[model samples]
Target: MAPHERACFYVQAQAPQEKLAFYFAVQSGGNFDIDYEVTNPAGGVVLDGQKERQGDFVFAARSAGEHAFCFSNTMSSFAEKMLDFDVTAEHETQADHPSRQNPLPNAAKQREQAAQSLSTIDEMASRIATGLTNFHRSLRHYHTRLHRNMDTVRSTESRVFWFAVMEVAFITGVVGAQIMAIQTLFNTSGKARV
Candidate 1:
């Protein structure tokens, strides 16, 4: 992004009352700070921050439509920003659990209870899977950053080492040239005019 430029994105929620979560960070840029805001479909600002490096927010969607998320570099005079962000929407299911059964026969009640138990187990497993996915993503992101940093450090070290070697060689050459010139002058002066 350029100075005073704005970058915006929109995410659409299919249903009302859906859970929308946003996480973002200024990973690298001229400055690690940016201005950001998230607005609902009604154009009302739901979340905002100024000069912030990172943010995490979870809010319920009031309506089914597009939500706008924006980042601005207006605060920076000539600095661009690199941002990493994620927006996740989870829709709550309206399925009725079998446990909410009315009065029934013994066998019927037992079957209903078993179905409810299975539903509960399935929900738990789904949650665990989602958690694991997020964890793995975070780990991969951090690992990439670590490797990039190490590469930069290694490249800088190599450049510095080569620069020092070149400097020493140049200095030695200059000293040798000066010594030779001095010796030549002395020998010429010591010889008698012939």
Candidate 2:
């Protein structure tokens, strides 16, 4: 991203009441922060943030249409940013379940019970899946942070080591020059006295 530049992406919701999940992280670059905004189908701001390194958001769609997710690097003057993001729309419609499509007249009661049980199980599974995804993303984010910190530490150590070496060399040169100057002065003074 360039200075004062904004990037926008669109995700379509197939139906009203659909669930939309947005996740983004700044992987590298200046300050590891960026501004983000999410707008609904009617162009109303649903969520907005500034100078955020990572965010995970889930919201229900108010209408069936395209939603906009925009990211801004306007705070960065000369550095470009690297980001990882995901947008997902989850819909729970009757059409998605095969058992709901057709029912037998004879076993209507039993089928209904089974369908309800399946729906419960399906909902639980979805929740678990979402949890795992978030955990994995968090692990990745931490790993990146640790790696960057280690690099900075190593760079500082190298600089300190070199500076110490240079200081020792400078001190040694000054001491040698002082000793030579003292010897020359003593010899000249002794010759004048003799």
Candidate 3:
């Protein structure tokens, strides 16, 4: 960086005594030759390695630090070119597990959960109201359509009844004419026509 110190501290967390990976960086042209040293609070170098240009190194952390990752630019004639770069470390993920803590009492949490459930019920009530209203409207429409069909059926039945009555009257008139004609034929043959 453009800072005067030119070196900053990095905090990497890993599982206890497990293998750890570190990504180290330095400026170009060898002005910044970077190195990393893992240590305990007892001021010991657990692991140390010189950083390569455009490279990375992985090592296990024997103990947690106060790990020193140092970058030196004085090793190059173009120290300005090799100023400062970046380093990163990746840790293996076992799971997204939070440490155990004191849990809240059931009374308070139950009240909060119940309150949330009540809000959900309220939302369902509104939806049910709308649904029932729609159902009622559909029912009314069906009833109206049924009434119209029944009226049409009644009108058809009335027409059929009138046609049947007219047919019965026509048949009765024909029978009466036949009987009268027979009687007249017999009477005229015997005497006069009536």
C-alpha lDDT score of every prediction, in listed order? 0.82, 0.87, 0.53
User: Which portions of model 3 show Cα errors greater than 4 Å?
Assistant: 1-115, 190-194
Model 3 residue 17 distance off true place after TM-score fit, in angstroms: 66
Q: How would you encode candidate 3's per-residue C-alpha lDDT over 1-194 as one tens digit per residue?
A: 33222354555544455444444444333323454455544566655665444333456666654455554433444334333233444454433212213335766666666666766776798799779956955664555446546656777899999999999999999999999988877767544533
What TM-score goes with each of the models?
Answer: 0.65, 0.70, 0.37
Model 1 residue 34 CA deviation (Å) reads: 3.7
Ranking by TM-score: 2, 1, 3
Candidate 2 per-residue lDDT, tens place, 1-194, comes to 67689999999999999999898887667777899999998999999999998888889999999999999999888878778788989876644576765789998888899899999998899899889987987886787677557656777899999999999999999999999998987878656867
Which pairs of residues collide in candidate 2? none
Residue pairs with colliding backbones in model 3 are 31-73
RMSD of each: 4.6, 3.7, 36.5
TM-score of 3: 0.37
Clashes of 2: 0
- Highest lDDT against the true fold, candidate: 2
Error of 3 at 54 (Å): 79
Q: Give the per-residue lDDT of model 1 (tens digit) for 78-171.
A: 7777777888887777566555556367678687778778788988989998899689668756854665466567778999999999999999
